[model samples]
Target: MTYSGAVKVGGAADVHELADLMISKVAVGPMNNNAYLLRCRATGEQLLVDAANEAETLLSLIGDDGIASVVTTHRHGDHWEALRAVVDATGARTYAGRHDAEGIPVATDVLVDDGDTVTVGRVTLTARHLVGHTPGSIALIYDDPHGHPHVFTGDCLFPGGVGNTWGDPEAFARLLGDVETKLFDTLPDETWVYPGHGNDTSLGAERPHLAEWRERGW
Candidate 1:
């Protein structure tokens, strides 16, 4: 299916995106996790971002696209359960944060930090560290050809809910603060966000909820 209003990156039309990004909802898992397939629209340089609980299905979904890399948002098993299979099938380099790299639940080839950027086709994704959801959770920010920025937030933030937390309440508060100060404040309020799960939302819509989030003690 063609994207009705896919934000175009201008020159990449000639550069050819080796793949397309497709989202899948696997409901049988603990969470109805969303997995994204990053296939090069031009060269078919496939990549998988956070395989859901169904590792095998994740493998089949790529279906010989010759995946080149796997990027995980955090250490949760439900999010990275298929890392091993995806890596085995495509020999793709895996990227994760240093702290969670141990529980990455699989081996990885790249360890990233905030401010780091990775290139695929003509797009650039910069990683930002958001600590509330997990100590090592990272959100990726990228600008489309029109200069509009988009963020791929792992589990730190969601459409209507932020992930459940286990650490200090103050830290969880700080996580929300990070979303405000680092993410929502830094990008255009129009920036669209693709969270690890749930439907997409924009910085503009969610920006207003920061105060509400603070009031509820989430």
Candidate 2:
């Protein structure tokens, strides 16, 4: 389906393009986790984010576009439920953050840390480690040549506030600080945010209320 730049959820959404990259999202699993298929329009080389649940659906979404790599945002089960199946089927390279790589069911081909790059065809994504939801939770930043940057944040930052802190004071502090310094402080307000589950938002929308999120301690 054509997206016309509007945000969509569930089923097969619009294929959003930024510069040379094309991104398609489908919500899968019982938790409604989002699995994204990112393709470099220049070369058709692809990348899959999360591989979260629903192997069949994920595979269908992948179809003939064979992926070059799959990046697991964190170690959460819901995020990688289809990881093994997708990897086994496609023989794609797997990457995860160094601190949380051990928990993933599949052996990681590359252990990604802060500042690492994951390329899809002609497009490149920079990895930013966000430490709260999981010890090694990572958010990828894609600098679009034609527009503002786009970030794929797996359960770290959302539309209204940060991901669930589970009420840990230190964890909350780390998450808040990392998000503010690494993400909010660096990226532009127009940056598009794609989360692990459900919907999407912009850094501009979530920027003004950083204090409120901290004060509420969520």
Candidate 3:
């Protein structure tokens, strides 16, 4: 899976690049939807993954490199309520699949499908369709400069549970199975897992929970 326009960071700025994808978590709702800003150390370009409900905090924290684009893992408002304001402030385009992209409260400037690549500096993200919670939920998978894979799982698979499947339970089940078999299966167990919300975890910690997940005990 590859998404186009991973976002090229502009060079020659005084910006202190966020080395190794500096992770920041801001509690954005009663439910605590976590928003992330992945900035390229080399280029200073940032990718806004799952903009939470507070546009002011996200904008200020996102910093001056200027958000190249915003991406939504799923269509949940908690994950993207601030997108409209973020887009207005940063003038960054929003990326998602055509069907669900429009649900982000702003125009989705770019449409991505499975295997499309979205590039940010040297990071290339491939969008994988992990439909379950929504009709067109996607997972962004890419390898960093260290070659360690990073998955920006937006509600598809959390540390202990998966996203709710209001649209289709069967599809949600398939999504769960697909995540276990497809995305997680392709990477090493030590790969970093960046979910839409929650503290960062590793594949090592999360993989073993699949059985419990399937059994609804996690």
Candidate 4:
């Protein structure tokens, strides 16, 4: 079946196979958080993005291959609900944004910043820090050598608008500005966005609504 990037809690993951990497996206927890398991085809090394919830389900997906690292996109509780459990089970190193590391209970094995690189086998991903949704929310960028770029946005950029700012105008503006400058302005239209929740969308599909999202001030 074709990968649609639509998943629900307790359901099977939707897997997308790239040239060198295979991405498995699954929804877990009551909030329906999306956790991505990235496996490098060449070496079978794996890395997980946001061990959101359902430690048993995540471990089942991981199987015997095991995992190397787990990255928390930000300090949000929902985003890392199963971080400790997953890390303890897999013995994976933990990574989180530098500014938000203190907020997470699990000791951060690595503190990521904008432009920092994390690797799964030979595949390297660049971290993009997107503020406002959280002080240190990060999005991982995988520039496929044979295809369009793929971004894993954590509560930063969603399909309809940027993540909620709780009616805070300043926070909304900062998030929009960072998204526009670092994401929309820099990435190509074909870039695939896998968000922290809900279905996936591309930059091309969302670029036209940038002005509208800003005007709404969400």
Candidate 5:
């Protein structure tokens, strides 16, 4: 229930730490949704991503420091199972992609669009709206002071290729094109990728397979 160690899809756990921020993740629910807790080291302000499941465990992880806000990656059911509970408990503001906000069961406080920034004390995360997986699917980009960018991709992207497009060719094309321009071309190879489920990967590791993924078209 608690975040005991780093979580991997099939390999070793990967942990990421930056100058003034710390990211801790736990895989929850039957779908193995990955929920993240980001804390500002200097201000102790925190942010939670997904709130996928296990409210008690998440609350414990949050503890007394409390949370500034909760950002839902997409409209998927697995991603917001614990959202209402966490929001009620912490009174933290809720943010979601504008187009996808209505899809979620709970109300969203702030409707974030592309380029919007969410701040937790000194830490700031830029919201990038990556469409296709859903009309408003989004990824959060954090430029770590230590080095490269860290992206919370949700289901829009992953290690081997882009997230499932559910056999929709048009959707696949949109997602792929956006990913290449918004993520691949823009971010460096060292950018870290954290998805809604499964292990983490880097832009460097997946960069080489772009053509292959494009050819395969998933």
Candidate 6:
């Protein structure tokens, strides 16, 4: 089946295949957080993004191949609900944004910053720090040599708008500015967006609504 990027808790994950990477996206926990399991086709090395919840489910997905690292995109509780369990079970090194490392319960083996690279086998993904949703929320960028770029955006972005700022205008502006400058302005329209929650969208589909999102001040 074609990968639609729409998943639900207790359902099978949706898998997207690339030349060198396989991305499996599943929704877990009550918050319906999206957890991504990335596998490098060349070496079978794996990396998991946001071990949100349902440790058993995650472990089942991991199977015997195991993962080298578990990257928590932000410090939000919902995003790392199963971090400890997953790490303990897989013995994977933990990675989180530098500024938000202290907030996450699990000890961060690596503190990632904007422009830092995380490797899964021979494939490398660049981290892009997007503030506002959280002090240290980050989005991972995978530039596929044979296809469009793919971005795993944590709570910093969603299909309809940026993450909620709880009515804080300053926070909203900061997030919007960062998203516009670092994401929309820099990435091509075909970039695929896998958000922390809900269905996926592309930069091209969202670019036309930038001014509208800013005006709404979400």
* Number of the top-ranking candidate, with lDDT as the measure: 4
Candidate 5 clash pair list: none
Report the C-alpha lDDT of model 5 over 1-218, residue by residue, as the tens digit.
43233574333223356788888887776787888899998999999989988887778778898899999999999999999999999999999999999999999999999999998889899999998899998899998877899899999998799988898989999999989999999999999888888878889999999999889989
What TM-score would you give candidate 1 relative to the actual structure? 0.84
* Model 2 stretches astray by more than 4 angstroms: 1-10
The Cα RMSD of model 2 versus the native structure comes to: 1.7
Candidate 2 TM-score to native = 0.95
**Could you tell me the TM-score of candidate 5?**
0.93
Candidate 3: TM-score?
0.83
User: For candidate 6, lDDT tens digit of each residue in 1-218?
Assistant: 89999999999999999999999999997999999999999999999999998999998998898999999999999999999999999999999999999999999999999999999999999999988999999899999999999999999888888998899999999999999999999999999999999899999999999999999899
Model 4 per-residue lDDT tens digits across residues 43-91:
9999999999899989999889999999999998998889899999999
Q: In candidate 1, what are the lDDT values of residues 1-218, reduced to their tens digit?
A: 43321222111111112123333322225566766665545555666678656766667667765677778989988888777876877788899876678887788689988888865554567888888777888888766665467678888888665666764687778788788888877888888677776666788878778788777767
lDDT of each: 0.69, 0.89, 0.71, 0.95, 0.87, 0.94
Of 1 and 6, the candidate ranking higher by TM-score: 6
- Which of candidates 2 and 3 is the stronger one according to TM-score? 2
What value of lDDT does candidate 1 attain over all alpha carbons? 0.69
lDDT of 4 at 202: 97
Could you tell which candidate, 1 or 2, scores higher by lDDT? 2
What's model 2's lDDT at 163?
A: 87
Tens-digit lDDT track of model 2 for 1-218 = 44533333345655786668889888785897888899988899989999988898888889886788999999989999999999999999999999999999899999999999999988989999999989999999999988899999999998888888799989999999999999999999999899987678899989999999999998
Model 1 poorest 10 in a row by lDDT: 7-16
Which stretches of model 5 miss by more than 4 angstroms? 1-15
For every candidate in turn, the CA RMSD to the true structure comes to 6.0, 1.7, 7.1, 0.6, 3.2, 0.6
Instruction: Quote model 6's TM-score.
Output: 0.99
Better of 1 and 6 by lDDT: 6
